[model samples]
Target: MQFKDQLDFVRQHVKKNRMRIFTTILATTMGCAFLIVLASVAFGLQNSLKKEVLSDDTLTRIEVYNDGNKEIEPTEIKKMKNVNAVTMNTLIQTGNLEANIDAYKGSPEVILTDFKENEKANLKLSKGTYPEKADGVVVGYNVAQILLSKEDEKKLEKEKDASKINIGIQESMIGKKITLNWKNEETKKKVTRTFTIEGVGPKPKKEWEQDGTIRISKEHEEALVQDLKTLYGKKLKAEEMIYRTTAVYATDLEAVTAINKALQDEGYATYTVSQQLEEMNLLFLALKAGLIFVGTIAILIASIGIFNTMTMAVTERTREIGVMKAIGASPKLIQRLFVMESAYIGVIGTVIAVIISYIVSFAANYAIPKILYMATNEKEFLTTEIQFSAIPWQLVVIAAAISIGVAILSGWRPARKATKIDVIQALRQD
Candidate 1:
């Protein structure tokens, strides 16, 4: 028979046993759906975690730590291949450095860094531009919030509920001049310097994180050091001006591994977000494999029903098979026809399962977070984007392959039996 004729034959047989075929297909559909939904949990969690990791700035940053004896040189690190920029921070050793703008004041940590290198490292700002002059400075996002007037400070001290105190710098800090005051302990004298606010740093990624720091250019820091030395009439020790943090920015994410390796080989200890993600991916891969394995058991169970249905189909059509063989039908054609019927069931079931799986995934992703929030009363669950179930196209392909492969295998013996039926013996059946 032609391919079209063979398909017609299978369709007629399926229609004749529509109720039985429907029931078998339902079983297969449930099996496939279960497999997809189960494995989808792994896919969803992996995607969520991967997104969170990639969102971090540290993904392309490799933090290099001095191995106690040797300090990391920014110039040497910049010479490394694929290194985009090297940024380092040194804490100002002045005691109790206080920043002031008009009547508002805040005591923020003073860090000295190279603005040119920071710009190359993709330093983000919420407002304004990086410092252009030596006396210009950049303040953290929370600096304005922390800068409270004397009256507001008293209100904060009296108020048991600190949140009730609604007092923070309302005006924009850009272009405003801020005063820095620190006491020279040995000299028992106070020193003051005025610097213009050039920019504000971007908000912290985590809600709990507070960025209340003031970053100054290296020239300004050197000037301050010189002033302190002039007042003390002595030279400051070199170790006292050591860098607190050194981070190497890779040219791109793909370059992080090579740069990190190069730094480690040079005897510098390094940490990268890419390394953490690699470990996390390996863990999730194993979890997905285990879930898929567990799901395959359901498909195997469903295949047993397909096997029985195909066997019964072969038995019931024995007289028809005999008639076909007596006329002109080859044994191979008869076998192929039976196998195609089983495959039809698999394809239809797989298609329906995929649709149902996607619907279920959407419902789970939507409802699970709300349910969790209701149960735990944690507001974060409602706000945070969490995927409880995800159905990727690759997952659908895997499920289809396994379901159809098992379905075809289950019908193999029945098709072989149909081919082996003797024409006379099959025709003699009542």
Candidate 2:
């Protein structure tokens, strides 16, 4: 038979049993939809985690600690292979700076290192410029909020404080001199000093954001450390004194492992995001495997239903099959007609499943983040802006192909049976 004639034969068969075909398609649709939802969720979670943990900072960054009580020298660390930059949080002595502003509730304990060249890469600034003078200090995004008075904080809750909340006004916190009261730890004498705010950093997206921290130049930190020793009348050894923990960022992500190894070899304790990424991958891999296992059960049930339906279809069309055989219709052609009908059912079912899955995915990604952010008023609570269900095109193609293959395979036995019908015997069936 010509291709058109064969297609017409299959088309008529499907149209004649539209109601049964619809039922079969519905079963397959439910199974495919379950698979789509599971796979999309798995992919979405993995994508979100990659962004949150592996953002610009952590991808190339490694935290170095002096677990052996030895001094960590940044200069020495810089000489290591793949080490792009090294910076330490500075310890601001209360002795040098008398007191912070009364409006600022907590004292800042961390300071940004004054590396002339790589400072921009190490941090993201939201406002103003880096501290250039002895009396200037930079603040983190949270620190900016901390600078507000109790009254202002109450106003923020009501969205009433419009002045300071503005971007330009908030950034204008720079150059404002905040008085600090410092008392000598041993002498019990109090002194006062004022420092100007130099810059403000953007809000932290992850734990890596140095929130509630302030930045002073490295020169000022060294000078303050020296003054503290002089006031206490004691010589402090490097081992006894805790300076700061340094973060050594590699040139790129691939270099993090090598640099971490180099740090460990040099007798330093180190932490890297790369190690965390491996653990996360293992966790998601297990989750995906579990989802696939559950999805396979659904598909198996659908396949059985479809196979049973196809078998019954051949029985109902017995006389038709015999008539075709009597007309010299090839058994292969007859078999192919049934298989193609089943495959078409699978294709239609899969298409419907994909459409429904995407509609659900859109609602999930859009609403979840906003709902969480409002509940907690914390950016971290929202995690990354990852879709709750992100179905990639590659996955869609693979799923469609699987559905079609299952349909064809499941119908094979019934198709073969149809081809084997005895012409005279099938023709006499009432």
Candidate 3:
């Protein structure tokens, strides 16, 4: 028989046994849907975690540490391949530097860094530009809010919530010169320096984080150190000259691994967010595979229904099969017809299952967070962007492949039995 003729025959038989065929298709659909929804959990969590990790600016940053034996220098790190920027900072051990602008005064931590390298590191500023001269500096976002007059300080102390006190230097500090003074504890000597407020750093990433440090050029740091030494009558140690912290920034996320490897080879210890993400991906991969394996069990159980349906189809059509054989139809052709019918069932069921799976995925993503938040009363569930279930195109292909393959296998024995029917016995049946 021709392929179209075979399809017509299968269609007529399926129409005659609509209830049985529908039930069989339903079983396959449930199995496929179960598999997809189960595995989607892993995919959802993995994607959510990746997004959270990538959102951080530090994702492309690598922290470089000295191996104790060798010191890490920003200049040497910058020379390495794939390095976009290298930044180093040294914390002055002296007490907090008291900054003054007119009547307002505030004490803030002092950080010394290379301005040229910091510009390449993509330092975000809320207002003004980076320092061009040694005497120019950048103050943290909180500096303006914290710099207060004596009266403002008294008002803040009287308020129950200090955050409610908004009476600080509200005017812009850009292009204004501020006096920074610190006293040498050992020598009991005081030194003061004037610096122009060139820029204001961006706010901290975390809600609870505060950025109040004053960033100054390395030249000022050297001058301050020399003045402190002259007063204290002691020379600084060699290790003290090394930067307290060094970070290397990559051109992009893809270059982080290469840059980290280069730094490691040079005997510098390095850590990157990408490395943590790689490990997370591996774990999720295994979890997803396990979920898929469990889901395939459901498909295998559904295959039993396909096998029984095909067997009954062959038994009921015995006389029909015998007549076809007598008409010179090949056994292989008979087998192909039965297999095609089972495959048709698989294809139809898979299409329906895919639609159902996506609907379920959408519902889960939409409702789960709200449900969790209501149940736990934790605001994070509602605040954070998370997916409880996700379905990708690749998952659909996998489900289709498994469903169709199992359907074909289930029909093989039944198809073989139909081909072996005795023409005489089948024709003799009343």
Cα displacement (angstroms), candidate 2, residue 424, comes to 3.9
**Model 3 spans > 4 angstroms off:** 58-60, 92-108, 142-171, 176-194, 203-210, 225-243, 251-256
Task: Report the error of model 3 at residue 202, Å.
Answer: 3.5
TM-score for each predicted model, relative to the true structure: 0.88, 0.80, 0.84
- Each candidate's lDDT (Cα)? 0.88, 0.75, 0.86
What lDDT tens digits, residue by residue, belong to model 2 across residues 269-309?
88888888889999988987788668767777899978988
Instruction: Report the CA-based lDDT of candidate 2 relative to the real structure.
Output: 0.75
Query: Which regions of candidate 2 are displaced past 4 Å?
Result: 54-58, 69-73, 92-98, 101-106, 110-112, 117-122, 133-135, 142-145, 148-171, 176-180, 184-187, 190-196, 206-210, 229-243, 261-268, 366-386
Q: What value does the lDDT take at residue 356 in candidate 3?
A: 98
Query: Candidate 1 or 3, higher TM-score?
Result: 1
Residue 66, candidate 2: alpha-carbon lDDT: 77
Model 1 C-alpha RMSD to native: 3.4
lDDT of 3 by residue, 1-430 (tens): 6778889988998999999999999999999999999999999999988887776657779988876967877778888888989888877765436789889998887888888888887877899999998889999988887788998988977995767767778889899888988766765677788999999998776555688878899887667787655654557653453347888998888888888998898888888888879899999999989998998999999999999999999998898888888899899999999999899889988999999999999999988889999999987788768878889999999989999899999999999999999999988776
Query: How many clashes in candidate 2?
Result: 5
